[model samples]
Target: MSAIDDLADQLARDALDAAARLGDDRLIDDISKAIGASSPVSQEAFVSAVRIRQALARGRAVMDSRLTQAASQKAGPEKSGG
Candidate 1:
């Protein structure tokens, strides 16, 4: 795979892992709060929270990918990098 594709795939896997670790219930709660309010201000806040969460997920994925790659490199040539 190209380096960019590899990186993306690795990132996706990491995000999935983090999501699993954090548990779905918490995520659901956060999403619910972000989208559940009535007032315009509250709705705006919710939207912002949703955006923040999305960004965080992306960050987590990137971090996970980097860590996986680092670990594989440390393990030597027999192992593949993420």
Candidate 2:
């Protein structure tokens, strides 16, 4: 596969993994309701909103991982800065 296609595939897999982790029926219902409510808006706006939400979610996940790693390092004994 081309580089872009491979990246897309990886992203799809990651999204599936994240969705599986959520595994909350109520959360899914809420998301569905939000999307349904957006249907009255122009198609462009709906697509933009979805993309923005996804980007924000990805950013949150990255920030969460960095915070967790920093906390773990701080909790452990100091290591040589080698």
Candidate 3:
């Protein structure tokens, strides 16, 4: 695999490890809350190779939302000339 492919594979495994260490139930809860899913997605349904990939995607969304909010808050004072 190319370097980029290798990195992608590594990240997927890392996410799977994180999910497993945290437990499927907990990861599902956090992921649901983060993604605002209408219904809970079953952790058991995830394949080993895909668990981390899915979790990372969901987690990244939450992180992006929080970071955007923080940046907006920080910019508010500047925008107001404060």
Query: What is each predicted model's overall lDDT from 0 to 1?
Result: 0.58, 0.57, 0.57
RMSD of each: 13.4, 12.0, 13.0
Q: Write the per-residue lDDT of candidate 1 for residues 1-82, one digit (tens) a residue.
A: 5554454445444444565788764654454455455444444444444456678979999999999999989888675588
Q: Count the backbone clashes (under 3 Å) in each candidate.
A: 0, 0, 1
The collision pairs in model 1 are none
38 Cα displacement, candidate 2 (Å)? 13
TM-score of model 3 relative to the true fold? Answer: 0.38
Candidate with better TM-score, 1 vs 2 = 1
Note the residue pairs that clash in candidate 3: 16-52
| TM-scores for candidates 1 onward, in order | 0.48, 0.46, 0.38
Best lDDT goes to which candidate? 1
Clashing pairs in 2: none
The full ranking of all candidates by TM-score, starting with the best, is 1, 2, 3
Cα distance off (Å), candidate 3, residue 61: 0.9
Candidate 1 lDDT trough over 10 residues, lowest sum:
38-47
Residues 40-67 of candidate 3: C-alpha lDDT, one tens digit per residue? 3322223333655777779999999999
